[model samples]
Target: MAHTLAQKILQAHTDEAIMAAGQIVRCRVSLALANDITAPLAIKSFRAMGAKKVFDRDKVALVMDHFTPQKDIDSAQQVKLTREFAREMGVTHYYEGGDCGVEHALLPELGLVGPGDVVVGADSHTCTYGGLGAFATGLGSTDVAGAMALGETWFKVPPTIRATFTGTLPRWVGAKDLILRLIGEIGVDGALYRALEFDGAAIEALSVEGRMTIANMAIEAGGKVGLFAADEKTLAYTAARGRKDAPLSADPGATYERELTFDVSGMDPVVACPHLPENVKPVGEVRGVTLDQVVIGSCTNGRISDMREAAEVLKGRKVAKGVRCIVLPATPGVWKEALKEGLIETFMESGCIVGPATCGPCLGGHMGILADGERAIATTNRNFRGRMGSLESEVYLASPAVAAASAVAGVIAHPGSL
Candidate 1:
């Protein structure tokens, strides 16, 4: 049977030689992840299970990124507990302070993720690793604890859904638009518990960063993973990161339960407007939409490459007169790299305020909150009704390029002209 990338990776982790959708299967997890927010709960549960140590100390990665430099008393306590738990558990891959960032970005960059592996993280965006042809999915804290105590987890092999994108995307239409369009077609719960595999020329034309951006939002569409076949771009990315030995591609003739085709040749930049992440519409259709704030950062598109794309459009321009634009790096490593590349200068010169390498406005804990009737265009993942600020405010989600261009124009503008 021909299997999609997600199917191939899932099958590789299964104990059975063959499996099908809805069938229970035990999988051998290659790696498990927990960040500051989830690690404390996971540790508490693991201790409750009477586990002396993690099944494999090196197999688990504990990162402190969410509240790194702790914003409040509760967050400070969470970080303290997580650090103590990691050290006591003998977890060798603990990352704290400046070392912490978004878990997904750090994992692949550090060569911790590879093809044909099953990776799980407490964060929903763990599906991002599917870009590497890995069977990655998000789990709750209890699941993380179970994986810590026993290096295995059970899954009901998800049915496969294929999205074949044809034609070339316009200059401003990016991976974010592609995913948003798909979500618009299928709605939020359409792909619940399903594995989505992207195919065709359009997907192949996308860069690794773009593919990652697409995969990172799989959860928004209720998918287990959103994957693309490992191709030259994937190989080049891994190689440049000094992980030339990672596996590549799935077997040809992979099987899928269903498939969809999208013709995006002339597709315009799309935005997932507030109230729901899946409420999407083309930017042109929603032009003149005023915004009070704009934010560009998140695990979804906070890499150096992503920042450069946004900076390129903002080089000689300034943010809209009254609108505030906040830019954040996903990780300290990405922040350092951007500083070295002068991207930070470009952003500052363009009148964009830059924040530390924290989740920042993405998670709504700090910075860039909106007032009633206010609107914002952000590069972060979700746009649920009250995600960034007040429940009365509205958020429109787009790519880094679109967010940057909109920030400068004071309206929802495409990045194609810039």
Candidate 2:
């Protein structure tokens, strides 16, 4: 029987000989992850089960990113608890302050996740791994604890939706715009419990980093996962990272519940307005709207490619007066690469504050929280109410190009405006 990439990957790890959508099946997990905010709870759950140790320490990753450097005494205690658990379990991918970064970005860079793998993390952005053709999804802390102890978990196979892209994306119009437009067309609950499979020439042309940006936000549209099938690009990335994993692809006649097509050549830069990632509109539709802050970071768009794009727009300009601009590198390694490439200097010289690899500001962790009535245009995934700070604050989601341009104008702007 022909199967979609998601089904194929799931079957490879599943014990049953035949599996179909909606069928509950137990499958082996290739990787399981947890972060500072969720790891403590998962660890507590793990201990309560009286599990001797993790199923496979090397296959689990623990990252201290959500509140890195410790937000307060409670956060510090949580971090300490996570550290002890990781140490006790001999976790091979434990990341702490200074080296910690958003787990979604760090895992891919380390080659800890790859095609055909079943990965689960205690993070909505764990879907980011699906960009590499992995069957990845996010789970709760208790589920994570169960996976840690058993190395396998049950899943209700989600039906698939294939979105094919055609033509080249216009200059300044990036993956973020494409995704935001998709969310707008489909709404926040569009793909509830469904797998979104990306394909076609335009998707193939996108850099893995760009695909990561799109896959990272799948949760915004209520997708079970969003992925690009294994192709030459997937192999090249894995090889470059000095890791090897079998690439998987959907059969030619694989099934999908519905299909959508996008023509990037005619697309424009888009932004998701305050309160919902699906409240999207073209930049021109909301141009000149004032902003209180601008941030370019998160697991979504804080990689080297994102930094380079933002730096280009800010090369000879400064962040608008009174509008703070914060630049976060997605990982320590990404930070070092950006620094060596002079992107860090370019940002700082342009008056944008360069921050560590932590996921600060994106989730109201710290460093750039907003005050009441404040509005920020950012490259992070979500833009829900109070996502960055006070309940009255707002966030607008855009591409690095739009973010950089808006930062220079102190309002929502576009790359063409710059």
Candidate 3:
């Protein structure tokens, strides 16, 4: 039996030898995570469990990112409670300030996740760790509290579905476009409770950052996890991040329950418009759609590479007179690197507002809110109605390049056209 990355991680953690789909199985967890918004609730639930302390404080991580810098009283209180709990539990890995960005972005950068590990977080984007060949998934706050007490969690083995892509993507086509297209084809709930394994030459050609972008959005399609096998590319990425000795890859002969094939050689850049992530249309079809705001950052596409790509498009071009553009780096590390590379200067020269390294407008928290009837084109993962602002506003989701190009044109435009 040839198992995929998801299968290997599940089997390694399983207490039972013969696990079947839909049958609950107890499994060991390599790491557990909670951020400010969810950590307070998880802590409350843990106390209700009457546990002496966390099963292993070292295995738990607390990150204050969702409301970094604390905007309102409720958010401030959440951060305070999360910090108090972390201090009392003696959690070794606690991230705050600019050190905390999106939980998924900070986890891999801090070496908290690695191949062959099973991680759980209270944020849906936790599945981004699957890019490192880890079987990571998101859970409810109560479920995280249970994992904190027992160091284990129950899971029904997910049916594996492999998405194999062949052929080179076009200049403007990116991982975001590919995943959005998949969501369009499968609908929002098509992959419910299933493991999505990406394979083939096309996937192998993508960088780790690109792969993370794909895995990060799997939740929007209702997938448990979007997994990619660890090849040399995976090894090199972790190695560069100071985890040179980390375990890597799944065993050969891994089994998959189903497979899908995509021919993206001629694929066009896509836009997930108005409300739903799955409501995708090719950029060619919607190139002239006007936008009031354009954002180029999020857990989905907020890495240094993503910033650089957008910066390149913004250079020598000012944001459209009436359009406001916001650029947020995913983490302080990414921000510092972009600064060192002069990418920050390019963005500022183009009249783009560089926000703090946080989730920012991706979740409609701190930046670029739209007024009634206003429209935005953003690089964030979801464009669900009212996600970025008022219910009357509209959002179109695209790659960072697309967002940047659109910002300069005052309308949706492909990066190549810039």
Candidate 4:
């Protein structure tokens, strides 16, 4: 019997020599992660279960990125609770304040996750690590508690959906556009409980940051994991991060439940329009839609590459008056790198506000929340109603380049339009 990339990783972590799709099995976890929003609940569950010490202090990560800088009394208290718990458990990966970044980006940058590893987090975008060929997925707070205590978790092996991308990406089009196109084609529930195994020349040629962005949005398509084989690009990325995991691949005869192919040679910049990620349209189709704000940062497109893309577009340009453009770097390191590379100066010169590394605004948490009836474009993952602010406000999702261009145009426009 052959196995998909996800199954290969799952099998390595479990005692079972063979496991089929939909079969549940117990597997050892390489890392268990949660953030300020989710950790408070997971910590409470950890105590309720009467587990004194975590399975391994080094294996548990607690990040405070969502509502950090102490948004309000409730959020501050939540972080306080998580902070105290981290100290009590002697957690080695606890991060807050300047040390913390978006959990998904922070973990991989720190080499805490690698190929063939099994990772579970109390955050849905935890599938981001699957970009590195790890069998990663999200878990509820309670389930995260179990993994933290036992160092193992159970999963129903997801059948693989092979999505092959051919042809080179057009200028200004990137992984974000590709993923938006995919979600639009499949709808939200298209790949429910299935692994989306990305492949072909285009996917293999994508940068590590690009791969992570695509995998991070897998949840929006109802995928169990958006995986890619640990090919040269992936292995090189891991090696640069100080992770030494060997590459892994699916068997030649691996079984797939379905297959989808995309040719990116002619695809244009696209966006997920107001209210839903699946409601995508080419940027040209939605040109001239007014906006009140534009955000360029999130776990999805907050990497250094994304920052560079935005800076390249905004250089010698100004954000349209009345539109509040906010740029957020994914991590402290990424923030610092952008500053050193003069990207921060470029954004500030363009009249955009540079914020700390937080999930702010993306989750309607704070910092850049939209006013009622206001419309904004963002590089964040989701665009659901009220996702960024008031129920009446609207969010349009696009890549960082598109977000920056829209900020300058004061409307939904493609980067090429600039």
Candidate 5:
């Protein structure tokens, strides 16, 4: 009985001896997460369900990363309610203020999620944890509430799509380019309701941080979850964070509904054009698209590696006049590391503003909202219409390198072009 990595992880959390794709199964949750935007609704749902206390206080995490620092009265109220609920429930992982980063990044960094775990969050990027060989996905607030109350949630197993990446990535091109290329080829809904299993030499060669970036954007292609088999790199990363879970991998004869292969050896830095993650083009093709803002951070590309790359590009260079460049480290630890390594100074010297670690401008929350008709090149995950501000504003999604280069060029330009 061969099983895909996703199937194996899901089955491991359930009592079922054998599980198939599409089977309805209730599995224990290793971690349940909700951010400020979603936690309030989940708290209301938790109360509506008459759950006085969470199923496992230690397993539930309430993060105030989205609209934190009190954007407005409404947002402040939302956090207040969530904070009160967290205090009342004695949830062990409540995070806010300086302790909060993006939930997807913070959870893995805190060692709260690991291999063979089933994690659910009220936000879509929860799938980001699959990079650690965990079965993680996004659920609605109510479903998250159920997981909080019962320590479990039901999932309709998604069939697997195995995507193999071969060859080496070009300079200035990495995980962000790979994902943008895939989405452009397959459109936004290509892998709808399917589990994306990534493998092959190139994927294995990528750093764990890069793997998390790829997995973080799985939802852009409508994937139920994106998984990478737990390997030495993954284990070492988790071990460094104090998690020692056993590595998980798919059986050799594992089944997959579809197979896709990508040879990235010849790929160049790419960007998801305005309005959609699927609307992508090579950076060279879209060169000279003027920009008003350039943001180089998000759960997708706000890690220390991302900051280092951006800093490398911005070193001794100034952001183009009239362009507002904002850099956000994904978490507090990432921020501290960047500061210690002088990446923060590089960004500031380049005329870029270094903001606290928050989802802020990525979700149009605040800190760097765009004006109407303005354009931005960002290293964030999505770029739907009005994602960063006014409905007339536009967002181009690219890797941190491209975003940094574009900030200097005042247009969508390649790093090599600079």
Candidate 6:
């Protein structure tokens, strides 16, 4: 039987000569990642397992990015616990303060993630690394602890759902829009426990950063993993940093549980409004809906390409009165690159506050909390209840272009409206 890219990677990692959907396999992990919110729990569980040391210290990366700068004493203590464990384990990839961004966004930049690798993280968005052709997914703290100790974790091979994007992607329409459209069409649980593999000419034309945005949101649709076939863009991104990932592809006759195709020509910018990431609507449909704040950053849309897109829309323009716009680069590296390109200056001159590389407002940890009855447009992953602060506050998920345009208009405005 032919195999999908995910199956191929899994079969290679597992002791088994073959792996199929629904089969359980314990595959060796190439990388293990955790953030401040999950690392402490993983460490505690690691200790409970009577493990004297991690299976591979150099492969584990513990980052303090979710509540960066330490939201408070409790958050600081949580980070401290992870730090001590990392120090004791001699973990080589530990990231502190300014050294880290969101683990999903930073690992690729460091050349620590690559194709055909089995990567797992304690955070759901870890699948973002799948943009590089790796078979990556998120596991619970206990799963992480188990993987940390044994260098492997059990997985029930998920059936693949092939989503093919054809035609040219319209200007201002990005991966965020494409993924949001998918969620809207299939609902949030559409791909529950399924591996979503994206392909076709449109997806092929996407930059690695754009592909990362789509892959990062696969979990938002209940996907086990989101992947793109590693192409030249992916190879160039990793190879320049002294890493090389052999490209992998699904066999021509690979079977899929379900198949979907989207024709993206002239696709409009879309948004996922309050209460659910699947409640997507076209950006023009939400025009004039008042907003108190706009956030243009997160693991989902905080890369340099996203920054350039936002800056392009906001350049020579000022934010609307009574509207607050906050922008965060995904990593310190992204921050530096944006500064070098003057994207940071454009944002700041437009009345947007450019912040450090942090998850910040995306998880309501800190930096830009919303008030009661306030509404914000953000380029983050989730927008469920009380996700950004008070339960009364609302968040609308959008692309960085929509985020910037909305900030300038003080509403959920479209770039065309501006």
Alpha-carbon local distance difference test for all models: 0.84, 0.90, 0.87, 0.92, 0.92, 0.91
**Overall local distance difference test of candidate 5:** 0.92
lDDT of 2 by residue, 233-351 (tens): 88899888988766678988988999999889978899999899999999999999999899999999999899999999999899999999999988988899999999899999999
- The window of 10 residues in a row where model 1 has the poorest summed lDDT is 244-253
Residue-level lDDT tens digits of model 5 in 283-397? 8899999999999889899999999999999999999999999999999999999999999999999999999989999989999999999999999988999899999999999
Candidate that scores best on lDDT: 4
Off by over 4 Å in 2: none
> Ten residues in a row with the worst lDDT in model 6?
11-20
Model 5, stretches more than 4 Å misplaced? Answer: none
Cα RMSD of all models vs. native, in order, equals 1.6, 0.9, 1.5, 0.8, 0.8, 0.9
Measured with C-alpha atoms, the lDDT of residue 333 in candidate 2 is 89
* TM-score of each predicted structure versus truth: 0.96, 0.99, 0.97, 0.99, 0.99, 0.99
TM-score of 6: 0.99
Across residues 64-100, which tens digit of lDDT does each residue of candidate 3 receive? 8877778889899899888888999999888889577
Native-to-model Cα distance after best TM-score fit, residue 293 in candidate 4, in Å: 0.7
lDDT for 315 (candidate 1): 89
Model 4, residue 104: distance off in Å is 1.0
Tell me how far the alpha carbon of residue 74 in candidate 2 is from the true structure, in angstroms, after superposition.
Answer: 1.1
Give the C-alpha lDDT of model 6: 0.91
